[model samples]
Target chain A: MQRSLAARVAARTAALRLTNEKLYNEILERRKAERALRATERKYRGFFENSIEGAYQSTAEGQYLNVNPALARLYGYATTAEMMAAVGNIARDVYADPEMRLRFQEMIERDGKVRNLEYQVRQRTGEILWISESARVVRNRSGKIVCYEGTIRDITARKRAEDEAARLRQQMLQLQKMDAIGTLASGIAHDFNNILGGIMGYVELAQDDLPPGSGAESHLKEVWKAIHRAKQLVRQILAFSREAAPERRKVRLAMLVSEATRLLRATIPATVAIEEEILTETDEIIADPAQIHQVLVNLGTNASHAMSGRAGRLLLRLEHAAIGGKKPALKLSVRDTGHGIPPDILQRIFEPFFTTKGVHEGTGLGLSVVHGIVKSHGGEIRVESTPGAGTTFMIFLPLALEAPQ
Target chain B: MAHILVIEDDEHMRGSLAQTLERLGHRVTTAVDGKVGVASAAVAPPDLVITDLIMPEKEGLETIMELRQHQPSIRIIAMSGGGRLSNEDYLHLAKRFGAQFTLAKPFTRDELKAVLAQALAS
Candidate 1:
């Protein structure tokens, strides 16, 4: 009986030792698994920290759960801690357009991932940055979205390049307009020069044949004066065409108007009464004296023609005015008590070859040429009139001052 | 009285020029083109020749050059509408090739007469 009890004790001891050894081996295996998991997490953190592109992880509510250094720099912050502290709501501060964030959420929910989404983002410094993002939705085991993971790339340089290209297109259009004008001028000068030559030649030949102080000489003299007037018209055409240089000078507006009025009175019918009103002593203006005279004469002639076959008052007024607070200007107003311009026709008046006057009486280019001259001189002209009441034309020219050396 | 040849492509302008020259007490002949003018001049050389620069079949420059080669002393007056060859270089070229004077187109009748008279006297 003693030998059997000893054998049972020995077997029980062996069984207890075997159970302890099995437990120790199990603990070692678990520790090795934990170490491997920790190494994997450390590798992921290093990759996120050293990435050039912005890396971020956010909750479905747009709360930033984690952000890398690149993401903080992109948000105009010196450090990730400062960026996190300042921007609590990524939807409000980062997304320039709030709709973009909503769209991103919708895309992630529908596809479980969003790729290459472009948006304008506002940084901490209030500067706009163009960004493209590729993100994936982090979902729970139940398939509900919990967080978002994304990589961002700066695309501001690409956006600026597109804007610059658009500006260059506009500049090319302006250059084309100037080129067309140059071509037109060269064509017209050829034909006009021929007509003047014939007129001048005939006048000279007629003068030589008629002899001085003859009865025919007086009639010939009248024809010669007409030719001289035509010559002046040619000069104006050449100036308008930019083939001839305009003679520019400092002119007194009041004196110019008075002179024009006196000249008009001599040729105007007795039925047509002329009046003048000088309101400002500010008569100084820089312009071509002869060209301005032509403008005044054209306006006066137009007024006279409008009042033909009827008695009317032709009023010329001069005044001083300031424009844009930059410089003073001389304003000349020519008002006629004749038929006014129709509203529909008012816009068309400044267009070339658009005239209400009968053929041979008017070349629709008058107002168009006037507009061109005014634009070239950096001045402005306004026309105000009511149909049947009469028309008034006001011309504004910059006041002449001594140019800096 | 000097015999003058007027070469022009326009019939009306040629007729008018002929009338003016005849009125000036000179015998005048008209040709509507440079080739006809050249042939006419070659057949019967005139004391003076006035030619328009641009013409069909033959241009004025060629006519003047051919005429000059035939009769170097023949007084030549060139007229241009101030088109392609109106620049000083063209004028200089005309002078170099034996043209006595170059009158810009659309020149007054007086200017033409004066230039003609000067060319003839020289």
Candidate 2:
């Protein structure tokens, strides 16, 4: 009986040892699994922290749950924690337009993912920047959206470049269209001049045969007036089409302006007050005096027309200007306290043959000729108008260097 | 009175010009084109020649050069109603080709008289 009892105790001891060994081996296996899991987590965190693109995790309500360092910097924040604290709602605090966020959410919900969604967002400094994002909706086991995860890149420079290219392309197309029109107009003008010459010659001969102060003489005077009008129209068309190259020389702009203003004074209505404010000490420019004179006359005429039938002030001013470290320039401004041009018509003012005046009042080539002259002179023109107030035309021309005495 | 030759393709313009020259008290001869004008000058050699720039047979520039070579002392006046080029441009080119005077067509009688007198005096 004693031997049997000892054997039972030994068997119980071995069973206890086996149970302890199993327990230790289980602990070692659990530790190995935990280490591997921690290593994988560190690797993913490294990717999140060091990525150049902004990585983010936000709730369905547009609250950022996690943001990488790159995302914090992109939003103009110094720290991820600071950005999280500041940006309470992504749509309100981040998006330039809140509607974009709704669109983004709709896209993700419908497609389960979004690739390269472009958006404009407001940065921390209140500056708007363009950003491109690729994101996916994180769903729970029940297929309900839990959050959104995304990577974003700042694309403001790219967006600006694209916009500038499009603008340049549009400008090129406009130039080509204008050139085609000019060629066609010039062809017609040449033929018209010939026919006009024949009529004018005949009319002059007939006038010489009629006695002065007779009723026929007065009637011939009217015919002469019509012929003069036709002549002026042909000349204007030629100028607008740039058929005749301008003869450029060293021109005294001050003298030209005074001469033009004097003519304007006589031609425009006497009711309109004329004011000249020539402030520049050196008003020399290497330009065609005739073309420059025409520019002034055209601008002045338009100013007078704007003030017609109303007692308004016409102001002509010349001043020196510094323009972005470029060549020295002179700025000539024609301002009138008359009815301003409407916004819709202002943009089309430089187009050839675009006129708002009555058929007899204008030929519609004035501004177009002015624009062409300015462009050929390597200058620029700008117009500003306020409805019911006035209109101002500013012309910038390069100053001519002093010639040798 | 000076003997003059007028070269013009238009019939009415040629008649009007011939009458005007007669009124101005000049002996006038008319030609239909540069070819006829050159031939007439080669035969008669008038004191002054007023030729249209754009013509059917031979243009004014070529006519002026040929006429200048034949009669270097003969005074020449170039006229045009303009064509592909402006009248001023054509007149400018004509002046370069030994034409002593230039006229844009449809010129007033006074303008015509002025250039005619200048050409005769020169």
Candidate 3:
């Protein structure tokens, strides 16, 4: 019996040892799993903090819940917490247009996600910037949307570049249309000149047959003078369309203006006065002499026409101006005190064959020729006018690099 | 007064021009266009041929060339209202093509007389 009792004790001891060994193994396995899980958490945290693309999570109500440093820097903030504090109301404080945030939420709600949404947002400095965002709705365990996760890319520079390209394309199209009109104008002026030549010739022949003091001779002379004026009109159109390669040379603008205005002074009526103010330190430019002469005459003729049969004053002024600290330019101004051109008509003053004068008085090529000549010289022309207050036309031409002494 | 042939395309221009020349005391003959002018001048070869440069069937420039080829000694005066190239220097080419003188259309009776006088004196 004593022997049986000792065997039973040994069996019970063996059983207790087995249970302790099994419990120790289970604790060791649980410790290994905890270490592996810690490593995984560190890897995911590094990815969340260091990504260059702006990463963010926002509540369904558009409140920013979490934002990476890249996102903080994008809004011109030094830290993510500071940006979060300043931008409490995302719709009011972040987006330039509040409607954009509402659209973002509606998109994520309807589509379950939103990618590449373009929007304009205001920075902390009050500067507007364009951004492209990609995002998806974050859902709870029950599949209900709890927040939105998003990424942003600033695209302001690319948007500005596209806008400038469109503007240049529009300008190029306008220039091409003007060139077509010039070619057509040259063809018509040629035909008109020939017909006038016939009329003038016959009138001159008829005048020779009349006696020296006859009333018929006086009438023919008046008709002959009128024909000469029409011939001048045709000449203006020819000059505008000729595209005759300009003979470029050193041009003295002051002398040209002086000669033109002196001749103009004679033609101007007694009531209308002509004044000159030559104040330019640099008055020379490289251009075609004949074309510059034509520009001055054409501008002067327009000023005279604006005051015909009405009392007015014509002012011709010149000055040297340095534009934006670049090369010096000469500014020539033709100002007149007369009934100013109406706003609608002023826009079309440079169009070829567009005129308001009586049919026989003008062919409307005068201002068009002036504009063409100025452009050929690499110059710019602008006008300032107010109805009843008169008009002022300003011409800016680059000064010659080396003027002839 | 001289025997002159006027070759013009327009009938009214031809008639009035004929009257002007005849009133200036010259025996004048007329042709409706460049082709008839060349044909008429070839028949008799008038002393002075006043040919218009722009005409139907045969142009004035060609008419002048044909006249020079046929009647080398016939004095020629080329007149043009600038057919297709009014703005071009077409009148200068007329003199180069053997037209003794070139005149832009719509000339006074006195201007015509001077050219004829110069032609006659030469």
Go through the candidates in order and give the clash count of each.
7, 0, 1
Question: Would you give me the overall lDDT of model 1?
Answer: 0.76
Candidate 1 chain A, run of 10 with poorest lDDT: A171-180
- In the range A254-362, model 1's lDDT, one tens digit per residue, is 8878867866675567678999999997687877765576577668878888888999989999888765656788778899998888898886676434579887667
Best by TM-score: 2
Query: Candidate 2: which stretches are off by over 4 Å?
Result: A1-33, A207-218, A239-285, A288-399, A403-405, B1-19, B22-100
Q: How well does candidate 3 score on lDDT at residue A283? A: 86
Which run of 10 residues does model 3 chain B get worst, by summed lDDT?
B81-90
Question: Which residue segments of model 1 deviate by more than 4 Å?
Answer: A1-40, A58-63, A88-120, A130-143, A191-405, B1-105, B117-122
Q: Could you arrange the candidates by lDDT from highest to lowest?
A: 2, 3, 1
Assign candidate 3 its CAPRI class: incorrect
Which of candidates 2 and 3 is the stronger one according to lDDT?
2
Residue B38 lDDT, candidate 2, scale 0-100: 96
- Model 2 clash pairs are none
B1-122: candidate 3 lDDT, tens digit per residue:
78899988766556667777887888998998778888998888788988876666876777888888998888998876542223234565567677888776555566778888888777
lDDT of 3 by residue, A133-239 (tens): 99999788999988889899899998886675565445435543544565476556645654665576567568767987998888888898888787677666655
lDDT of 2 at B45: 95
